[model samples]
Target: MSLKVEFDEPKCVAAGQCVMVAPDLFDQRDEDGVAIVLDDSPSPDQYDEAREAAAVCPAAAIRLVEG
Candidate 1:
């Protein structure tokens, strides 16, 4: 199983939910605080945390695609 993480910068509200949930998978930009994708393809161990990040995101900026 393979998973992909995608972040929408324009929709980011700097809520920091993604970072709080999955620090290794997502990060905030120093300049704008918009969430950035750290690892597009995460390992199986990170799938749950990645899902939590997306679920906790207030701006709904994080997206998960599994293939």
Candidate 2:
């Protein structure tokens, strides 16, 4: 009924798009150029946008866990 997201830091390449797409769900640390999850549970309305963000990630660091 919902979605889950997890990021592998070792695979992250500091592309801040995910944060840009969903500020409520993610944050980018400009100092280190890495994304940090701000909230694990994004609203259902945001699922599509979040999935798109994951798809566009240059490093392919985002994982979509179907619920």
Candidate 3:
């Protein structure tokens, strides 16, 4: 199985939790502090961190799908 990351920009609140949990997989735009996904499909080694990032997202803008 593999993981997929999705971000709904309109729902983002610039909380930065995702970035804090997984800096290598997520980032924010300098223009407006909106989240900018760095990796949509992270390696297996990063799955835990990526999952945590999605969990910690206050805005609930991050979605993780495994298939």
Candidate 4:
């Protein structure tokens, strides 16, 4: 199974929860503080962290899709 991380920039509320949970996969822009997806396709071992990041996002901007 492969995991993909999707981020909705428009829906993001500049919350850093995703980055806090999964720094390797998520980040915040230096200027606006909007969440940035560092890795859209995460490794299998990082699947749990990816899911956690999505779950912790207050803005519901993060999504994990399995393909």
Q: Which ten residues in a row have the lowest lDDT in candidate 3?
A: 25-34
Candidate lDDT scores, in order, read 0.90, 0.82, 0.93, 0.89
Number of the top-ranking candidate, with TM-score as the measure: 3
Q: Candidate 2: where is the Cα deviation over 4 Å?
A: none
The residue-by-residue lDDT of candidate 1 on 15-53, one tens digit each, is 899999899998888998888888989999999999999
Residue 19, candidate 4: how far off, in angstroms?
0.6
Runs in model 3 with CA error above 4 Å?
none
Model 4 per-residue lDDT at 48: 89
Off by over 4 Å in 1: none
Q: Report how far residue 21 has shifted in candidate 2, in Å.
A: 1.7
By lDDT, highest first, what's the ranking?
3, 1, 4, 2
Better of 1 and 2 by lDDT: 1
Q: Pick the candidate with the highest lDDT.
A: 3
Q: What is the lDDT of residue 60 in candidate 1?
A: 87
Residue-level lDDT of model 2, residues 1-67, one tens digit each, is 8888888778888878887787777888878989987766667998987798788888888888888
